[model samples]
Target: MSINNDDITPSKDNEIREPMYGMSINENPKERNPNSSNKLLGVFYGIGMNVNTIIGSGIVTTPGIIWNLVKSPIVVLLLWFVGGIVSMAGSLSYVELGVIHKISGGETKYLQTAYPQPRIMMSYLFSFMHIFAIRPGIISAVLQSAAQYFWYTLKEHQYDDGIDINTNGWKLPFTPFWYVKLLAIAFLLIITAYHMFNTRWAIYINQTLAVIKLITYSIIAIAGIYRLFADWPTSRTNWQNSLNGNSDITAYSASILLITFSYDGWNSLNYSLDEFRKPEKKLIFSNSISVGIVILVYLLINIAFISVVPAEAILDNDKSSYETIAVVFFYKLFGQSPVTVRIFTALVVLSVIGTAATGIWSLFGVHLLSYSLEVIRYRNKGNLKKEKNDKELNEKSDRSSKIEYEVSLFFVGIFILAGLFILIFSFMVHVECPNYNPNCSLREKRIEQMSPMLISYGFLIIALLFYLFYYCLDTLKRQREAKIIRIADK
Candidate 1:
């Protein structure tokens, strides 16, 4: 007997009678589009991105600052440990959110999902802060830090000419002020161009740098361990009274804040979920593993610092003279050799560059602006069905073009603004402190006056007020619509 195709319905158990090639029986074929781009990332890339983002110049700089503030090795280690725990918790939360959404734009998506009553108000606020302040600020800070390291390396060589009198090397002819700003701008352009073209290659380079970062920190930790064993009595003395120091609450609070900032990029992977091949399945593993590795490396590095450098020396090291804690740590370990200084400086510069590059990739990956536009379009169309119609495809193309333009414009604007600020600050410093004295109170005051935190908080306040106003208007509009419907029905 011949059976009609219409009569072939699903069985009571709902078993699949046919499966497509390269697909599991339970998998949905529609989820895997054969015509899409083949540049999707996997679990390892996600881990690399997160690790690169999380381990920036902070790890090399903050430990000494924290130790100076709290004046206790135990408190410094505790703060770092607690910061890691807090960051891990936050990462796990983001993993759950990313899995459910299975999209990019990170906190913007979460805010929109959680608060839909105000009609995109929450997401708008977050996007405003992120695009305007947070993203650019992070990129600028990392690039500037890298420039500072480069300048410090030059300064070290210039002053230690006696040690390297026979060695000939190239050097810049500008002052530190001009040198740093120009170098930072140069780094920004190069990194921007690197990511703008050949995204797959950029990801590979970032992953390689992440691995190098891991190896560098591991070597430092191993050296510290060897030092601890080499002189057990001295190292034991360093840890004997770890808790014997001032307990000023204000300083302790500040140290905690610094540590928390060091752990800022734990949610880096969430920003690129759409790029991942199987985000839902790999999100938890990627985030957990990355955060776990960071936590372990951070603790070990801190222990190593304490083992090699005494707390008194760390606290007493003149901030004006030393570049960073990592500098002091290496100098203590390998002596004041110019070669050792240059080697560690290069490593730190590489770390900063890796961080800035990954940050650029995450921020400019078309996820943020495209997601916003998609949300707006979806609201206007009202649950439209997806079809491969000409008009629909055209609209998608237009949107793609719009997103590309906006992303380019925004990227350029950020760098321009950063450059302007650097120039303005440099001019002011030159005019006010002609001698470039490190102890100039006016320089410190000028920096404090231009604090980004205050500006960010001001934006936050404005956003909150705007949200309340929008919520009230939305509620009233809903009530009016309901009344009109009731009257028509009656």
Candidate 2:
């Protein structure tokens, strides 16, 4: 009465699953490994990763810039809310792609699978922009904000002089270029090493930092709310003043750009759908809840900031800079001592660095995949050589494998090179326009500030459009093939 294992019927435990990226599933149950640890992610992990990725320097530094543009605090809040809505829409689109493809590699895989017959030039182009410009640009931007806060704090404590936004156009002190660069490089290296050597500790650090960030922001919000309610007469005047300015289309566009960039990391979990246990349910909940939290916290932070520090102080045209708005707000709250201000800045910087550290590994891996097509071609050529020589492919395969390892190393070098270039680019932008200068190196400043906007919004728009176009094309092709099969069977 004993049954052979191979003869056992396919049941819930042994059912064959389809390939993640649309390649044929190996239907032979024997081919499946039972001990692999590639289980789906739980809800909390997915949400934590999403929130961590979404909350970066944007929330800290961009508020003043957003205020300067919109002028009206209510309009600014509305724009942030709209940005959250757009982010949710983008997330749902990505989730749909995940439900269908269920693979990693984000947009690259989506484009490749959707347009398999065409040259797939769009996919490569997307990867190229992401690797060379978008990813590096965003990282450099955040780190630029980090370096600003770092140098500002250092100068405050050591020199007893606040950061001068108009000293020879450099955000650094007298000998500040290399010093700031060194700090930024150190920040990058330290975070990188933390994740590399102490992965579990890094996770703990990220969660701890996230909690600290939440607590700090909540304190700021609560303090402002208490003040608003406690001093209604003064708060009323400030609110009325906050709404008296005019906003043009240019202002709206600028505000939208900054807000969207701040929300850029909202769709981070979409890149790693394979980790999700139930993306269908979890994806919607995670994206929606995380974005909602961000929007609420962002509004509260803005309100708190304006409550303590006047709107003009935030958008100060001369002397005080917008970059130091948070410092000023804290200063007004905590008096002239640099200790409280420095601590506040440090907390903000740590939150940003934690976000970058959480995602750097994935960013590096995506950058390495720039060589994917090259690696595939090299392998095919090696196979051809083995066939022509009638030699066993074991040696050829070994050589090909060695070549791949070398190629990977080469791309790692490229990643480092790109980072250096970006770091330099970031520093140059800071030097050119340290304090949101009206008349700086206009071109470099725009490239530095606007690149992220173009890439973030541009990528989302192009991706969604491509998804629709290719989804329709794919459906038609599949229907035609099915009709042919039905006719043949008849």
Candidate 3:
């Protein structure tokens, strides 16, 4: 078994580019830290990344959808609270597996490590689904919402219809069909370009946007609370009706899907565990803190939404949920001034853009994992030749810059194509929906367009359950193995 000397040596860049026991998404040239022992990030960074990734279009748009289905503010709140719990549970599970495997891939690493028979194929399938269906679907949905708001702001100003100044801000009397969609595609492309080329700038932009989003949310929450108590007519009947609407298992299930979507990224920080200073302790702490913070943020935001906007209004907001229920709530607070609406709409755009950026950034972690697994055959081979073969492959790979660039481009191309395909499909679906329902509202059409994405999440949830089950079995097996080793030694 000849070891690759180049593998052990630093490159011309004076940095080692080896994947740890796992590869992380943070392997870009500028971002790579050579010293493995150096821990750079703290709990706050983790929380910021997690929140940015989790609280996107779902929070802004899904509340109305949930209210439309669940019809109970209390149940919706409970479901969101429960979603946080589920997220925390998932985070804890990831921490356990991450500590042991210490891999860069998120769920892909979990599946690869936990499943018996070493379902490498399943991991590949997961990567395929993630790049094709899951990431693009959700991202397109988010971009669509942001674009809709952006367009809404423009159209309101352009049309200048006789909108009541006392009720709602100036709104477009009708949707701008191709223009809004082209704007959405442009939004997606800008985000993709930012991440694909200027990742450092993208990170800075992401962090700044996250801070702005939190502050905006705080302002919204405080204003809503003030209105609820100080100004808005206090109606116990309104509160009761919100909490006592008709409950159905199906409704709860659908609401749970969206709620969990809002809470989905809590475990994202675990993918970069190697970056943490004291990963064993810090990973768990950061994840727990982040999830707790998300729960608080989510609950407060929902509370604010319900307080300022009545439940009936939210349920009937089928037309403009694609924009934001909060826009209407803010309209009620700040009056019908176009400036207020534009500022609020612009904030929503920035917030969702941050989310899309974080999500795309986090996705590369799984891609890195998949790439690492693809290159390191010995990890799963369980044979004596594993190291020698991997070493040979590493040497060949190290010598060839062109091959690596080609591979990188190949993956990047795949992602871009998938994104474009989904974006086009979203617009096509929007254009064609009227054939089925002549009077389909924008929010309803948006949801209809998002159906494929919801289905993708459904598949992801099933995969998550599979991981949990296998993780338990893997844990027990390890425990049993330790027990046997101890007995034999004794």
Provide the overall lDDT of each model, using Cα atoms, as 2-decimal numbers: 0.65, 0.61, 0.63
Model 1, 1-490: lDDT tens per residue?
A: 0111111111112222211122332344345665434656678877877888998877776777677666667777888987787677677766766666555677776676577545767776887677667777877877777787776676763232232211212343345455677888998998888787887788788877777777778877898888889988988776776534454655565566567667778888877766677666777788889999899889888888778876666544333222266666677787858788778777777878888888887775335443544443434332233343334334433543321111134434543553354334332321122243455565454555445666877887887787688678767976887689799999
lDDT of 3 by residue, 421-489 (tens): 434444333212223445646666456657676787777777667656766785697688768979999
The clash count for each model shown is 0, 2, 0
TM-score of 3: 0.68
Compose the digit string of candidate 2's lDDT tens values, residues 1-490. 1012111111111223223322232233223434323445767777777777887778777777777766776777787877776666566556555555444567766666566444465676677667656776777777767776777776763221444544434456545555666677788888778877976687788788777667766777787778777877877665676644566665666666667778878767756665566565567677768877877878887787767776656655454345556676677777677788888778777777766765674564455434554444333331222332223323333432321111133434543553354344332322134446566675665565555456666766776576568668856976887689799999
TM agreement with the true structure for every prediction: 0.69, 0.68, 0.68
Model 2 clashing residue pairs (backbone): 41-275, 41-277
Which scores greater on lDDT, model 1 or model 2? 1
Give the number of the best model, judged by lDDT: 1
RMSD of 2: 13.9
Poorest stretch of ten by lDDT in candidate 1: 1-10
* RMSD to true structure for each model, in Å: 13.3, 13.9, 14.1
